[model samples]
Target: MSADGGPVARHSPARAAVRENDTVRSSLEPAGAPEPIGSMLARNAARFGEKAAVRHRSGEGWSELTWARLALDAARLARFMEDAGLRAGERAAVISRNRAEMIVTELAVMGLGAVYVPIFAGYGTEEIGRLLEHAAPRVLFAGGPEELEKVPLDRRPEVVVDYSGRASGGAVPFAEALARAAFSDPGDAEVRRFLERAAAVDPFEPCLMMYTSGTTGRQKGVLLTHDNMLSQQRALSMLWDVSENDRFLSYLPWHHSFGGIFEKTTALYNGALLTLDDSLGKDFDRLLENWKEVKPTVYFSVPKVYQQLYDHVVTHPEQEREVFHEELRFVFTAAAPLPESISRFFADRKIPVLEGWGLTETSPCCTITDMAESRSIPGVVGYPIPGVAIRIAEDGEILVRGPNVMRGYFRDEEATRKALPGDGWFHTGDLGEFYGKALKLVSRKDRVFKLLNAEKVVPTLLENKLAGMNPYIRHVIVVGSGQDFLAALIFPNYYLIRERFGDDIERAEREVRESLRKTIEAFNAEHPVKYERIRAFAVVSRELTVDDEELTPSLKVRVKNVLDRNEPVIDAIYDPSSDCDCRFLRKVFRLVPDSRKCFLGKDKTLDQCHTCGRVVFAEGAPGVGEGSVG
Candidate 1:
């Protein structure tokens, strides 16, 4: 198809001579090779018109839109927004879950000079209001009526278009809006106008306004240009063996840059199939059921997803191998720190999990393991990708500079100054060291704390190591900043523990503590360091949820929040006397033989410390592999 979405014309000699190799991109045929993403979309539509460009699960089954079809649909959508008075430099808010329309709307919005702000599906009215106040978008494309209702009537955009057909309350239905604006034929003047408008767009202009997940504080908007996104895709295409035929089973929330820039836009740029996990929600069971049908070549998942899948593999280990071994081209992980256990699990099966690292302000990917070029390193997220430079500060903080870096945080100059320094480097806050040529990611630079004994503790590294060894440990937070010894507040998967020790909380707690001790001991056995060891632990009964501000939307534990929330329990653990009557952490006094009559009474043994048997806390226990905790 041509730019007008009509019959294609034979390519000119110059166009035909453009590099078609996987490594040599078309834009790079002339030296400085970055182009607008809209141009890339046009190229894909022309090259592979009838090929499946996008897909989503439908009532009948999987439904796909051809490259030609998407190009036409995008044009119509752009025209509709234009007709509704959306102009260049204005903003449009996309309040939807991961869907084909969301991608289409983004591309359409980009083609116009308008930026599109992605609102993650689960945001509450207050959160939505907070975002709306910042962006003040002229148009809002809601996934459903429920999504549309989150915005106050006064806060509603000038034009409200509902993607899902099952929406009401004064919103324009998606199909009707497009039909009203669309021209019947390519020969129509309006069609020509739409094409001209798209072609006139400046690649360097701001095209994206992505909001952070706000784990630390208020969510800030990160503005990115078309060049920034297009540069990343082009740079990535050179490293990975990405072809026009590669298909992806995408489940990553599209609101984040990792999903939007890497998965969705990558598929569109390469003319590959992006099979949406239309499980209605990000239901793992439903996702697995859909997996049998899609059988994607490339898979991108967070660490938790792999942990859940590993749970299934524990019962049916070989089944997962048989399914993914031959079919999967590459399995990648990001968003949160990936446990080494999952990497080793896949590695043992000769299918490695490639890890990548980045922040939202950097188009979410500064470094990625090139599956074709480099060997997999379990914990290290590989070398920096092309066009990106990495430097380590004196404090071990990773600093990055690249075309993919955002222009700045939208309307937040203070944040922009602190994050993206005037020196042109963005402070990643993540600590990393070079392992030969590859980068080995350590814990956050700020999260590292010194114990009262003057020993340094990287909490996340210790947490990941412990979590890796145990199956029942859901989450662990190492707490010992300016304290004598390290202690952990553990959150176990209570359902599984309850199944093993039915209705017996005391027995279950004891067994879990014993099991956790064994696991952490195994980890310490591998390392000879005494200061890195965790001395004691207290298991929490309740689960952590984003609702309770325990976990971020990406499901990362907010350590400060956790620490602040459990300050009393943490203080109680470090108390000098064993007589404290704290609810969360209590002391079990070591009774003498005479006192045993009151403590253990007739059940007291000669060898065992009878009072210790009743205690939930593992107090001042020496490190089994090294030395004492204090």
Candidate 2:
């Protein structure tokens, strides 16, 4: 039986009915039955006072914070925040790279019953403005000056606090704040009162405003409460055993659910050691280096990270096997359905890869494959976790009712109504099926483009970027819906190509590929956002025509026909092993740093990025190989 496949054992008296009812899929441990994370922090501090709660890298070397010290510091920060006039349920934003201060500041804010809005540190001025406008935080807690700098002058918060002690534009240093909170007069009447406020926080009150990439062209705030998050700990406890002895290597974004609930909160609740993703200036390889130093037993990452590890393992087979041997208990992956090959690769080395599926609305995890389940099944997302009931709607969309479900979208009753259609059934827009007992995803109901990480992608914006890249690129349609990376079906401006590079069709093809390659490379460099990068593309020589069922009456490219017509070619690009031959409708495109320079006949040549696929184009006349593409 899967970890989810267990008889109900623990719950409150009110939920005892849920435990007995076969219809209500109650968790093995009653959801929302355990104390909140705030209490867990207190429990952990008392239980494991001297033990290191977390580890990170400073300018000099590695640094750590003991549980007792972390609790004290967090409490101090909360007291300092209370002195700064931050009231309960108020909002606070934290913009920082992956660092220890991120966790410290977040926990501190949450402890004081304030909402913690975690924005991606690298967000540009526009993104920063949008989030600030919605959140309207009382005080902005940032890592350093650079983070505060990202906020546009017009959208600056009322109070800016640099938790990293870096000075920038009217922001107070964290050290100063802490010192003031500590050195206040012993007779100050408000100190004890404020500490009492922090201690008397309600577990069900909304404490997090996790914003999701709005599919409808605006960011939506998903409100998570203490009870919603607390339920996550007890729910997943049935699957993976997080012990005080266990160490977790965390690099996933803290704003994202997997990192926040699975690793961060899990670490605190279990009194385990959490090693931050101290990559030292965006150098992800530093994570691998740190892993060697702190061999964590349990590791959690997204599909992208696992894919990157696959690349490393392939590049350095011996070293990878040495690092990922049997010592590592579990490497949990979610955010997207992983290719079976990845699960097999780790399995071959005696390392287990646990695949899971969830949305930001569900505290990030709903169905996670445990020891009983196998990732070998391609689309499996495992059975619904304990205390979560899954039912399919008439239109095939997945409907979930669970304690992990969020209260609602912040200040958007309409969206909340649409998402949670009352009677406790929340509409999860994703289509799912049961592969026996496990939940296997099918497709999405809406046109919202979710990349490998479930982050929404704007189709029109990406298509425009590609079309503007090369003059020879006439029509570009971004495909790979619900897949790992984006791929494009491009219609070449053959007339312009021939006019520029002579009427030799063969020469034109080579030059077109070269120009297309350069355009993609520039795009990758300029606006290389995660989950939206074009890792592969295909070019078709035959002009798209309405008569040929490729373009619509208004001359717009018909997406369905284009995809259906180029199904083999698209499949060939993503999964080349099935095709086995390097033959496509026109040409295959892949993005990489170094490409192999291949020579066509008559001293002409084009470079092929070998890393993107399993096949290579035949070194022949490119013009003659159009409609009869093999």
Candidate 3:
């Protein structure tokens, strides 16, 4: 802690601070070489033939898929698609969660040079229908009857393959499709034709059409080619040393690039065994059980999963050895900034915490944290990986140019033009600055809002700080925009609050609010900048949910949806006369005149009010208590 009460950015081993440089491009040159995804799979199948290529929980135990089997199955599936009229350059969509079949479908579609479009499994019937119409895939692979039902009978593709064995709804069972396309002889005409087509596939042509997560706006289909995906693998092969001996336990959805392209591609390209985590990160107990079985060499997930693992190991010390086994190399986290505590935990265990930064259009990996150095600051997402170039725009938005960058948004030239100007640099819309050669992310360009006074506010900075302030804080959304002062809607960790304060609802709310009030005061004092410090905060009664459109499928909060849902609470914050059922931080603010002292005639400074004279006391305010406004 600094004397001013702000967090001091200290290196772990406490090394001398290096001077920040202005270099923008990656320091390392392009290493290794790119290989077509189809070719890479064939090469691996020959080298690691009969070795476990993928694993998943079977009926009572686990089932393994060998490289030879995986390649053969993918080939059979590819043949089925070709028979179903899914020709080259056509799109094939899959709506499924992580499983052994997802990879098979991926390889099948890409092997025939067809575009692979993966829809989020959590998408509603309406969203699924809309994307299916837009993608117009010749073939659709659904996880089961649930996803298959999402597509209207009239709107269903020419062929539908369901992973579930049941053959209802005109959908062929996945196994049945593979069997129908199977040939007895390896050198049969069908097999030879499939191989010839796979070799004829143009690596530069579009092989993937992934939709953006759409946290802030509607989803746009981003078209990526095989070269785009393979380039990232080439870059990582230079930095990482994983081989076929390594193991991976993955739950991240295949619909997104982080899991689909980055994690899954690494496993297949390197011949490593990737166990499909059925838990999908929702059930930690099941995940821990899988952890004991898989003992992954390199784990990749979000911070929430890491926090759960950390909490478990901290409480159950005996399980530490199993959780952090000898084969464990390093852990990678992204999608959001990781808490310093979680990074420290891994660093203490001699496991480097790797954080990467990029957009879906960049094949999701442009920069990676240096493995050689100790963990730097929490937000520093290290130097650019090999073959990628990063440039900080004058306005601070990160611009990227590389083979990994997408060709364009599918069928949306306008959107593509805006993202990728004629100059070749793709605008990432994420704001960041260089710390020496490493990139430290700020806020999303759209998330930065200006107040009525024209003072800009970066909410993510305040949000991250507030999140680390208390364990009870599950999520925080700082809102001020065009208003005189900033405020926050904080979702508390309900389990922890109930554990501490017990079942009485009102009592727990009251106690937690009081505790949060003290912490917010300290946060305000530490951040004296008027626009940065949160002047008011309300403990949100309910948690945000994906069903309510408050969060994306990847669990990213949709800020616009949050604000739209909490309009009343926001109105009440600015206008205290409005009725709102929220409990605000008590005694943290006071309505005062132009004077910098308390309106209650106490020897209190503006620091005590925490409002910095930006708020005024409205008469007959509904929740005002003495000098404070609830």
Q: TM-score per candidate, in order?
A: 0.83, 0.70, 0.88
Which of the predicted structures, 1 or 3, would earn the higher TM-score when compared with the native?
A: 3
Report the lDDT tens digits of candidate 2 across residue range 100-122: 77676777888888899987676
* Tens-place lDDT digits, model 3, residues 1-630: 222232222221112112234435644444555545787777776688789999999997999988877777888999888889998899999988888988888888989888999998788888888888899999999889877777777668868899987648678999899898757444356655665566567889989999998988889999999889988887777567767877889998889888888888888887888999888988777888899988888788987788778767776789899998766777888888777777788888888778888888999898877766766585688777766777888899888878899999988999989999888799989998987767789989999999989998999988988887776777889988998888888887764665456778678766776678777778888986867777667666677777788877667789899888887667655663344332432222322222333332232322222323323233223322223333
* TM-score, model 3 to reference: 0.88
Give the better candidate number (1 or 2) by lDDT: 1
- Model 3: ten consecutive residues of lowest lDDT: 8-17
Off by over 4 Å in 3: 1-23, 184-193, 495-511, 581-630
Give each prediction's root-mean-square deviation over alpha carbons: 7.9, 13.0, 7.2
* Position 340, candidate 1: lDDT: 63
The lDDT, on a scale of 0 to 1, for candidate 3 is 0.76
How many backbone clashes can be found in candidate 2? Answer: 3
Question: Model 1 — which ten-residue stretch has the worst lDDT?
Answer: 22-31
lDDT of each: 0.70, 0.67, 0.76
Per-residue CA lDDT of model 1 for 1-630, tens digit only, reads 212232221211112212222111112211247677678766776788788888887787778888777667778888888889998889999888888888778878888878989987677888888898889999998999889888877788778999987788778988887788647553456544555566567878898998887666678999988888878776665555556667788877788877877777777776778898866324667877777678777778777777766665665656685456455666788877666666767766655466778888888777766443334454577656666777777777888877888899898999999998798788877887766555677887778899998988888788877776787888889889998667788788654565467799678766776687677667657878877766656666567776677876677787778888876556545553233223444222221122222221112223222333333323233322111111
TM-score winner among the candidates?
Answer: 3
